[model samples]
Target: MSADIEVVPSTNRKNAFRRRGLLAAAVAVAVLARVFMFDHQSLDYIAFIKRWYDFIAANGGFGALKHSFSDYNVPYLYLLAALTHTPIPVLAGVKIISVAFDLVLAFFVYRIVALRRPGGWLPPVAALVVLLLPTVATNSALWGQADAIYAAFSLGGIYFVLRRRPWLACVFFGLALAFKLQAVFVFPLLLVLALRKWLPWRALPVVPAVVLLLDVPALLAGAPLKQLLSIYVQQAGSYQALSLRAPSIYQFFPAGADAAVIRPIGVAVTGLVVLGLVAAVVLRRATLNPARIVLMATVSAILVPFLLPSMHERYFYLGEVLTVVAACYLPRRLWYVPVLVQGAVFPAYLDVLFPKGMGKGGQPGMIIGQAPPGGVATPPPGGGRGPVIMGGGPGTSMYEPTLEYRILAALMALAVISVLCTAWREFRRS
Candidate 1:
């Protein structure tokens, strides 16, 4: 019997060691993949980020924050300012910042998975899956977008919320909101928790407080207080299009459809969806569980971006990650959610990264085609060259919903419905 116990201990040690080895190998592979992708200079980099970096460098690092140089929030601008002081190439430094958060995002995934499904290979595998996700990889390393930074904090918020740490959840979520307004995609999930009493209502103030608190540095550096607070407001009014290549309900409308009429309708529809989610939580608070929380988060992440106008293609980043976490939580039933979400979002990234100007034979550029009536492309904000239309002149509308985006919209709509039905069934069961 003693020998039997000794053998069991030895086997467990070997298994633990093996899991560690696998995780390390996965991390190394993920890092090397990002290294190869560091060379791609995305339009965002060339047009906006690089210029912003140079401006900060020329104007004396953090002191440059006082001027309205970029439309992005102060938190990210802080990163750009700090990058100016570093010797690393601006492109690589920006991508590296995102990659670091990509790992943090993956660690949170691992933690969330291990929280519910402990003592197994599934947790590390989930982390590996996140690091290797196509959008996650490209958003950071290839395109040099900071979606992962906000995404990492958002996931950290979700993990803490699941662990019943409401204050920490708010802090992390505040950090996310500080990075991007798109972080509001997950706000409804937090509201659901608050309504269900999983998180205390008072702790909610921590979110905006944290956002404001982080602005102190920029404020001290002479950045206008009002401007820092209203950055998101400016961002909201910056783009007039119904969709910025986002695979949303706007895709179902004609490219020439009047934005004035459609924009309000989209907002109203998104509001209704959010209200419906809140109602579900109120009606079935007892049914709330860790898996269900993830499912509802997945729903918010998908439905908000899918229904709202003025959304960018990468707005669905959280949805893609949450679907994976949802699948890990209930692999047998929800395993396909991640696949569908990724399918719906990944092509949009490809379309943006390799626009029509890049020439064909590689990634598709369905986002930029068929300029509006004027056939002129308006320069993107922050003073970069406007999107190049193959045959059209500048100052024209550069965005027209292509068949590919329409299909993506439909797929996302289907995902939203499928997840909603599943959530309803689970709530009813409880």
Candidate 2:
């Protein structure tokens, strides 16, 4: 009997070590992919560095605080500015900071996933898949974007809320909002905490209080209200065009349609669709897993911008991060799809954003075929091969179409459908 017990303990140790080894190998691959494969030339890094330097030089270090409110609401700007005094290269500093945040995000995922479903291979698998996602790796290490940081805070907030720590959750959620406007999309999920009666309804003010505390620095720095509002106004007014990536049912339409005509129509349709989904979930008595709620909110946020006319690829950052957060609670099989989609989309989007020369068998001139009116391509009156796609100009075979967009669209659709069905099923079961 003693020998048998000893053998069982020994086997457990070996299994633990094996799990650790797999995790270590996975992390190494993720890190190497980010550092060596994708960090070729980070445009976003360069932009942030230049913007940071300009902010510092123009307005003393503290003065740079104004830029945060007036331009991007990214709180990390101040953090990055604080690091400027260090001898480290700006790009290196940014990459280090982002990677650190990614690590925190990974930890948060582990905790959240483990909490939702205990003692399973699914949590670790989910965490590993999230860490390895091409987009997450590339965005954090290569582009040096702070999406990971905001995502960390968002996940932390969700975790705390799940643990019935409302105040801490509020603080973390506020910090997330300070990091990026995308955090607002998750704001509604806070009601879950209130619904659970984890905290008094009056305690809800703590969230805005924390947000104000973060913004106080800028306010005290003499940033004007007009300027502050301008940041939002600029985003709202600009980019009235449409793209295939839009999240709405409207994406089925051709691009370049008039915003006046499409905007209102799209808004009404999206509102109805959103309402319908919410009703379905609620009416079905779905199980209110905080992780799944976060996933839905994240998907909603991502789709909001996509469904809206005129969005950029970077807009998917919030959704990508939320997908990671959702992975913590998802079954292992479900986790791999998002990971693969994120990985595939990140580099492809970057390629389009910052192209190197044509790959092969590609001529220079624009491949102008007759696109219907309101399509992405604007055909001439003659209907024979429209004008060149102006941004890169003709001969930019690098701009040639690839399967990336189609793949992403398909995967995203699959994910949305799968999650919705799962939520409905779980709701019914509950």
Candidate 3:
């Protein structure tokens, strides 16, 4: 088909085009990474960087790592301690860590997609699409958040589980939960797998063991065993709001909603939805295929964030990657899935970075707390204008992003339903 040569090139024009596209995507990632690398955008970088660095400087960095009370667990804190002593600007260093994982997350996503949708441009293109998602980019590079860290491991765990590597999958899941509690987004799916007999219950013990493994260093240090064990339990009590300003069903309630009542109400509703899903999985146990199970996991990832009692806007980050897996697996006509999922997430980032400065309770100066030797001696971060957005007026609060988030939440709910229906249909076909 070549105009200048009688014989075709060893690599056809189509193959050449695909290679060119992949190269272009790689270039785009590099340029974007550089842009994010230097942007100095978030308060999280300022606040946590100093707190962590000071923790290292306060006593011995190793002692700080052993004590473990940074709201995040040992795995992340250990890395922070190491970086604290490094010469790199703490903000840039952490953001770089986040950004680098963003690509690893992209790689795992590509592997998941390629496992099912092999050939042509789908895998690479899908990975680029994920890397470029506004929420994904903003959460790591701009907001300096670590959702991607958990997401990468969770996705890999799911992938490995499907590949029949149960112990590896368990370890990956444990790694995810160790990074962040939101990693529970995929926790329910593991439950579904255990019920489906894809994973043996005997192998399930590996999860807790791995979690203990992550905590071993802290325990070995003088860190109270009670503190290490109750880390998540106490974190759950830190915010009592029905929504904690999450983009979900709770957003439909009146702006002045009461947590005492609304919390129980939300739980009751979420419980019913989860029960419905679990029932569906049980009914389809015999027919369960990897794609269907993936769809179920995607459903749980979205549903937990959507229906749960005390979710934050970023809690649903798992859906972003899991849907990609499901899309490529079913290769279903569901392009809108990721679109709807991320709609609320990026807006919440804007809400925090408001020009007015984190809107109320937003304190001034670097924060060091839980009052350790290095603590600037400020009180422990007492949910003050906590980076965790508390309840707000509909459009009435000085920080008026609530109304925008409410509208987006409703649309995201619809998006959840649409994807579920599409995946359910595919499950039946499977």
Candidate topping lDDT: 1
lDDT of 3 by residue, 1-430 (tens): 3654644564577687877677577847654764654566565555555566677768777687556546666777777777767898777777778888888898888887777777667788777778877777777877778888999998889889878899999999889888888888767778778888888888888888888898888777668877788778767776666665567887777766776887877778877878777777677654766677678788888878888877766787888777766777765466667777777666765665543432234532222222334544453343222443222222223322367778878877876897779767765664
For model 1, how does the per-residue alpha-carbon lDDT over 10-58 read when each residue is reduced to its tens digit?
9999999998998898899999999999999887777678878998999
All-Cα superposition RMSD per candidate: 4.1, 7.7, 4.8
TM-score of each: 0.92, 0.77, 0.86
List candidate 3 stretches off by more than 4 Å: 1-9, 12-21, 24-34, 358-385, 388-401
**What tens digits encode model 2's per-residue C-alpha lDDT throughout 252-284?**
554334657877787677667666666565556
Residue pairs of candidate 3 with colliding backbone atoms: none
- Model 2 spans with C-alpha error above 4 angstroms: 1-18, 21-25, 37-39, 47-49, 67-70, 192-200, 244-251, 283-287, 290-306, 321-336, 356-407
- RMSD (Cα, Å) of candidate 3? 4.8
**TM-score computed on alpha carbons, candidate 2:** 0.77
Clash count, candidate 3: 0
- Computed on alpha carbons, the lDDT of every model, listed in order, comes to 0.84, 0.60, 0.71
Ranking by TM-score: 1, 3, 2
